[model samples]
Target chain A: MIVIENVSLSHRDTPILRDIDLSLPRGGITALVGPNGAGKSSLFSLIARLQPLQKGRITVDDMPVDTTPSRTLAQRLAILRQDGAVANRLTVREIVGFGRFPHHRGRPAAEDLALVDAALSEFDLHSLADRFIDTLSGGQRQRAIVAMTFCQGTDYLLLDEPLNNLDMFHARQLMRCLRTIADERQRTAIIVLHDINQAASYADRIVALRDGRVIADGTPDDVLTEDHLESIFGYRMKVEHMNGKPFVLHHL
Target chain B: MPDRRMIVLAAIALIAVLLFLTVGLRGNVQFVLQLRALKLLALLQVAISIAVSTVLFQTVTANRILTPSIMGLDALYLFGQTALIFALGGFGYASLDAGTKFGAEVLLMIALAGALLWPLIRTRMDMNLMLLMGVTLGLLFRSLSQLLSRLLDPNAFAIVQTASFANFNMLRADLTILGTIITLAAVVVSWRARHVLDIVGLGREAAIGLGVSWIRTAAGLLLLVAILVAVSTALVGPVVFFGLLVAALAERVMRTQRHALLLPAAALIAIIILVGGQTLLQHGLGGASTLGVVIEFVGGLVFLALLFHESRK
Candidate 1:
């Protein structure tokens, strides 16, 4: 379980996140949905310790995020930021291989290589594994990056907008892959998503944020109501039920 | 694959050394050989120091076009020497202990580099800002050194000029031994941290996400770069852009990002260039030109080409 209490962050004297308190349980998918400038990414950065904690405390499975050693935290949690750019001229396979660094620290045993192979196939990137990242298409590159993050073999995966640059088919495929990983591997994934219906269909719980505060947190049925989304997204959206799932008409 | 290339490069460097040492032995064999040996040692120290330091600096900065020399270290070195001559006079400066002089120059370079580089690294701002600041600082130091040079007496200026130029003929055995020791230590530490350096080349957030202590690693590598630039500048008076040439050539030749391979590859290339260029200058050119001038010409062209290539991309 991940626990957050009174976590507030300000950049250059302007508050980005404020007085947030929440506990995410183990072994399920949680989607963080919000409008633009809603501070979802900042919250993920704080949890990943990319940005130093300015106020309050967060613990991952009873281990404090701030106090734990980096290697220890890395083994338990992995994060993929949206703005990550690969400037090293590395091949897809080589980039994915770096995910095992915490486990092997440059001396990769056979098992690490096997895990890398598994990640490559898991993301349907086996054919493009040898291509350089710069040469790959945006959707292909996004899949490759996700493959690298998944190769870390962490229990908790926090991905901030992993669907960018992906086509609808690839995005759905990736969401399904994440769902499978969560259910089969017993790992928890907290993904920041913009698509409302995708989150409604896939996430076990949806956490809606507005102005750096959680305004709604519950199952999709409870949080995907037209009233709740209008309050969070600042617009009227038609929420209809299909096969016992809420489908949002926010595209218009 | 890189192993085979490394062997070929090592072989080439060995042949260069042989040709350099035995190509033309004249009047007194023993006396000439000893002098050439000292010069060879100095060349090796400078080559290793510059190549290793530049590669590491580029790794930490995540830039292929940067070197420790870019941060005004070599300019500061000249300023320090010019200041020493201006204060002590030519004769008094000559009388100072070589070890003391080398020690003082190295300390000053390290201090100045630290002051200029650490704050930027800590804040993690736009890297272009850091590069701009480095170039600006270098210009300032060069201007200051030029001003100092203008004020000195002709004779005093000559003394400083000889020390400032990249000349291998004035090798001192005591300073060579000291440099060899310091360069060897820095190389060993750099080799030990080779893997961390590879991870760092991935950028700061990626490195930190991979569990690397970003501040500690950057600080440690920065100090190592300062030490290396200090050693090479003290020994060779700064062969500007030569490190960029070697590193760029090594990356093209090795085709690998692993520092374990890149370090040796760059070192070997530096040795080949220095020793081979010296041989060509001495024998082929009949001492018509200096190796430093030739290197600066080639390195500058390569730097421009790299800038052009990157901009187009």
Candidate 2:
């Protein structure tokens, strides 16, 4: 379980995240849904230790993020930021292979290679494994980066907007990939999502944030109601139930 | 086992060395060979130090276009030269022990480099800010040097001009021992951290995600790069574009950024360029100090081409 207590963050005198307290249990997908400037990415970055935590304490399975050795934390949790880039010419396989760096530390044994190969196939990246990341399409590159984060073989995956640049088909496929990891591998993934329907379909729990605070948190049916949607997104959307799932007609 | 590309680069580098040593065989074979050998050693030191430092720097900055020379380190060294000549009259300056002057100059460069670069690394300053700072600092140093040059009496000015000049063909061996020691140490440390350097090539957040103490690690590498640029620039004056040229060429030829391959490829490429260029200048071109100009020309072209290529992409 990941625990956050009274976390508040301000950037240049403007509050980015307010006094936030929450506990995320192990396993399944927990989706963070919010509008722009809602501090979703900021919260995600603090949890991943990408940014320094201000006025808060966060622990991942009883290990404090601030004090734990980077390698230790990396072994337990991996994060994929939205703005991932590769400056040099690197093949998708090579980039994914670096996911096992904590284990091999530059000397990759056969087991590490096997894990990398498994991750490639897991993400349906077998055909594009050897392709250069710069040459890949945006969706393909996104998948490749996701594959790398998954290959870290960690129990906790924190992804900030992993679905950006992905079309409908690829976005659904990527969410399904996350679902498989959560169900079969018994991993926990906290993903920042903008597509309400995608979060409703895949996430076991939905968290709604607005104005730098969590306003609603519960099962998809509980937090994604019409009124809740209006309060969160500043627009009323019809939430229709189809096949025991909430179909939010946000586009309509 | 060395990669095949590395093998080819090594072979070419070796051939360049042989040509440099044997091209103008004359006089007492022993004396002439010894003289060429010292020059060869000096050039090799400059080549290795500049190439390794530049590669490490570009990785930390997360760009192919920014070399350590971009940090105004070379300009700073030149300013130190002018400052030294200003304080001590030409005769006093030339009369001082070369070893002391070189030592003082290197120390001053490292001191300023620490001041300028350390905080930027610690705070994770934006790349654009760092670049702006570097350009602004470089301009200030260059202007200061020119101002000092203008203020000197005609005799002292002539002395400073001759003293501050970077002559590739006639390098003194006074500081060769110390420079070699520093360069070798930097290379070894750089090689030891080769794998970590690869991880750092992944941007800050990615590297931190992958278990690197991003700030401390990048800062350490930046210091190493500073020491390297200091040693080389102090020995041969500033060769701004040489490092950028070699590093970019190495990446293109090797086709990857894995430091295990990239570091050696860059050093080898630098050796080929410097030693080969020196050999050509002495034997083929009647020994002009135009090697520096030629490097600036080629390196500037490489820089522009890289920008164009990136923009097109």
**Per-model fnat list:** 0.42, 0.75
Tens-place lDDT digits, model 1, residues B1-313: 7799999999999998989899978889999899999999989988998899999999988888877877888888888888889999999988988778788888888888778667766775555676677789889988998999999999999988888778898778989988999999999999999887777888877777887867777878888988988887877787756888999888866777778899999999899889988988898888888788877665567657866876797
Per-residue CA lDDT of model 2 for B25-72, tens digit only, reads: 988999889888888888899899989999999998898878887778
> Any runs in candidate 2 off by more than 4 Å, and if so which?
B121-131, B163-165, B169-174, B297-313
DockQ of each: 0.63, 0.81
Q: Considering only chain A, what is the TM-score of each predicted structure? A: 0.97, 0.97
Clashing pairs in 2: none
Cα misplacement distance, residue B183 of candidate 1 (Å): 1.4
lDDT of candidate 2 over A1-252, digit per residue (tens) = 999899999999999999989899999999999999999999998999888887989999999888888999999999999978875488899999999997778899999999999989987889998788888888888888888899999999999999988888878888998999899989999999988998989999998888899999999999989999999999999999988889899988
DockQ of 1: 0.63
lDDT of 1 at B254: 76
